[model samples]
Target: MISSNKLIAAISLAVVGGFVAEFAKPQMPEGSNPGYMTLISAAVGLCVGWRIMGPRAGRDSSIGLGMLGVVSLVFWGLAVFGTIEMLRLAMRRRFDEPVEALEMIVTIALKYGQYLAATPVYITLAVGIVISGYVTNFAYRRWG
Candidate 1:
């Protein structure tokens, strides 16, 4: 079931994820170590691209799919990294209750969203998504 569209979308989103991680690094709070952030983001991107965006490439307008992909990527990335942060905080005894810890995941994700909104990360993501969508569509038309 492998296809050129899927491969291109995965790789394209992976690159977008790395760029977003790098762009967000400087905006992070001081002394925060973003260990493996880029790698993790890229992995998330690959999964989202292949699973979410790949199959829908040629089924709709490329621009529409690209917009959806950008939204999906950002949403998944925030959820994944926010949960990681919440877990890290929980391990450090930052939360007094399990429910509080769960709530903090959303809080942390919103905070991350604030950081993204304050930077050019969205622009990069949008552009990357659009280009990837078009490219994937092209591959589909050419190879399938």
Candidate 2:
């Protein structure tokens, strides 16, 4: 079993790595495909999670690592788009008329709707991580 200090270091490194990827995103060429970035980020996240979390003594943890990567992607994707949209809305200073207000509101709603369309992936990643963590912990205590 890995020591607690080592585990914490791994997790910290992973989180920092994840954030680095996230922050470097905008510096990447605009118009580049975001899907590709997402995949790369997920891969990085997985590596970090796995490195930190480690595999149980004799069990494969590859699947769990992959799930963690996916979870990171989903969580980050939502956060990125949500924050951008909110910033855009916040930056807006005026709506010309009732109709304009309605239009702006509708536009914002539509953007949010599209953004939230990926909810299943997010939910799956979230539930998978929680369940996997619990199972890993349980297995470690019971079987290790």
Candidate 3:
């Protein structure tokens, strides 16, 4: 029994993340839309938090779910954008120079981490992340 308000906030944040992705236009081909990745990531994160925490019927659980949903947004943003950028780098062979297969893999791993650590990932979710936190904080304080 997920809280309706929390669900709505989660969904809205996903949508906001999508808009960010669409505008960011990092590695996507011209006219390509990468928004769906953010959408899917947010949905998956919500599901994951719901599944692990179980029904949100209980007061404690509802609060937990609310907080989890907010945190999940961060994870989703990082993972979805990071993977997309990493894959783009790999596909374009954007490394400084050609390398052995094993080296390529290692370099990709490192770059992936760097992408995750980059500012744009957080920027994409900037306002939305704050909104999520406020939503959850409200949920916990008001109802949970």
Question: Per-residue lDDT tens digits of candidate 1, residues 1-144?
Answer: 898888888888888888888899888899989999999989998988889888887897888877777788889999998999999998899988899999998999998887686447878977886898898788889985
**What's the lDDT for residue 33 in model 3?**
55
Can you tell me which runs of candidate 2 are displaced by over 4 Å? 1-60, 94-144
Clashes of 1: 0
> Which candidate achieves the best TM-score against the true structure?
1
Question: On a 0 to 1 TM-score scale, where does candidate 3 land against the true structure?
Answer: 0.44
Q: Give the local distance difference test score of model 2.
A: 0.47
Residue-wise C-alpha lDDT for candidate 2, range 48-95, written one tens digit per residue: 445544453124353564355444544544454445445555568465
Candidate 1 colliding pairs = none
Q: Tens-digit lDDT track for model 3 on 14-119?
A: 5554555444456444675555665565565555444432233234443455455545654555555555565667678776654543355555445434434446
Ranking by TM-score: 1, 3, 2
Better of 1 and 3 by TM-score: 1
Top lDDT prediction, candidate number: 1
Q: Please, what is the whole-model Cα lDDT of each candidate in the order they appear?
A: 0.86, 0.47, 0.51
Off by over 4 Å in 3: 27-35, 48-71, 74-121
Question: Which candidate, 1 or 3, has the higher lDDT?
Answer: 1
